[model samples]
Target: MIGDEVQVAFTKYDGSPHWHIGTRLLGEDEHGTWLHSPAGTFTWRPGLAFTYDRANVLCVPRGQHWAATLYDGGGASAVTTYVDITTPAVWSAGRVTMSDLDLDVVQRVGEEPFVDDEDEFELHRVRYAYPPELQAQARAASAAVLAAVTARQAPFDGATAARWLALAEPAWTPVAPPARPAG
Candidate 1:
């Protein structure tokens, strides 16, 4: 439902926790389900946590193996967009979870978009014992996302994200970083 809070979680291929963040459901379109993580949203992993200094929109395309995060521009960080090649998202009880494939497509301001984290992907492939089919699927998803983002394709293009961002701004509530959980 639009305006509802949702938890987004990512796990490694070996099922280790990766990133987990809280976001607001920003409605869906032909592209996919859109989520808004406004500035100050808390994102954390096993040993790291931080608050976002800029707003971003997350798109998890239906039946797609990739998810994209579109950032607000003009920040010190050059990253304008980041796409994670992952297993298709599974939603349950107001949460969405997916397995991060360790491959990413990044678009930086004033630079050509490129696939990042090949080394990490290769390392995890061995460590996690990814099956041949899974490896091939991850590679294919990376390639497809790279092309779409590079070509400014719909949902990859800032326009679609911008519209969603605007809708979220009015209802945005500030989020503080959560206290680190005790070991």
Candidate 2:
């Protein structure tokens, strides 16, 4: 449903929790399922919890190893776009999940897009024992996403996100994520 709330969860390669957030279903397109997270939407991790300061639209592309969140800039962080290289998303009744590969492609306002978190990715690759094939896939996905974002490709271009955000803003309501389990 267009206005239904959905939980988006991420896990590490070893299956530990990474991030979980709530978003509203903002419909789908040729690209994939689009989700809307308005400002103040709660996000949770193992020992962290906070709300986003700016609205963003997340696109979970079908059968793709990467998912993207396009932000409406001018917030405390200048990050205008973030694409996570991950395993293909698994979708269920009211939730979606993916294993974060740690390599991220980011584009900050007015700056060239680049691949971020390579150090974390390298550390985790050894720590998690990511297979050679998986490592290759992650690296390839990061490079591809960085290029697309730099070229202002559709969806990464903000035009697609703007349309979905417009549809969602009017009916948007704040939704809290499930409470994080005590350590």
Candidate 3:
């Protein structure tokens, strides 16, 4: 099922070393799909990757980024939602993948939704070697996300996610995943 717990992964910002691990599909809609963990997971990414790794204590195994809330999902909470912002996720049956577009939306209880690590975005833009086309796309997408988040649009406003959270509650029934033929 699309919303079921499955192992998945994405490229590091540098776009090498493809690694797919575990997380839930959450749900999907016109806005896009969401990946989440009730207790975050450790996403292995380097600081140079411009990934959000605040208060990182684990780095020996690999230069790790803390996803302190991703170990599991399908649970709903109004407080402390670590919404990962990417180029959206593409799903096929029980599998999923997305680009690490280098920005994440952290929606907490009372605070306004804010995009994390914009500095990382700029730093990586110069530090790493992103192709010109992907560079343009990333900049445009990042800007658009910032603008929409600033404007509090739809899902970014907290309303849509909140609604989804309610729907993801344990008692809520999950539907059979839709067929995602390879395009």
Q: Which candidate number maximizes TM-score?
A: 2
Among all windows of 10 consecutive residues in model 1, the one with the lowest summed lDDT is 173-182
What does candidate 1's lDDT look like per residue over 42-77, in tens digits? 899898887788889999988889989999864567
The count of backbone overlaps in candidate 3 is: 9
Q: What's the residue-level lDDT of 144 in candidate 3?
A: 62
Residue 78 C-alpha lDDT in model 2: 91
TM-score of each: 0.94, 0.96, 0.55
Query: What are the per-residue Cα lDDT tens digits for candidate 3 across 136-159?
Result: 766665556556656767555556
Ranking by TM-score: 2, 1, 3
Tell me how candidate 3 scores on lDDT. Answer: 0.46
Provide the overall lDDT of each model, using Cα atoms, as 2-decimal numbers.
Answer: 0.87, 0.89, 0.46
Which regions of candidate 1 are displaced past 4 Å? 174-181
Best by lDDT: 2
Total clashing residue pairs per candidate? 0, 0, 9
Score candidate 2 by TM-score against the native: 0.96
lDDT of 1 at 34: 93
* TM-score of model number 1: 0.94
- Report clash pairs, candidate 2: none
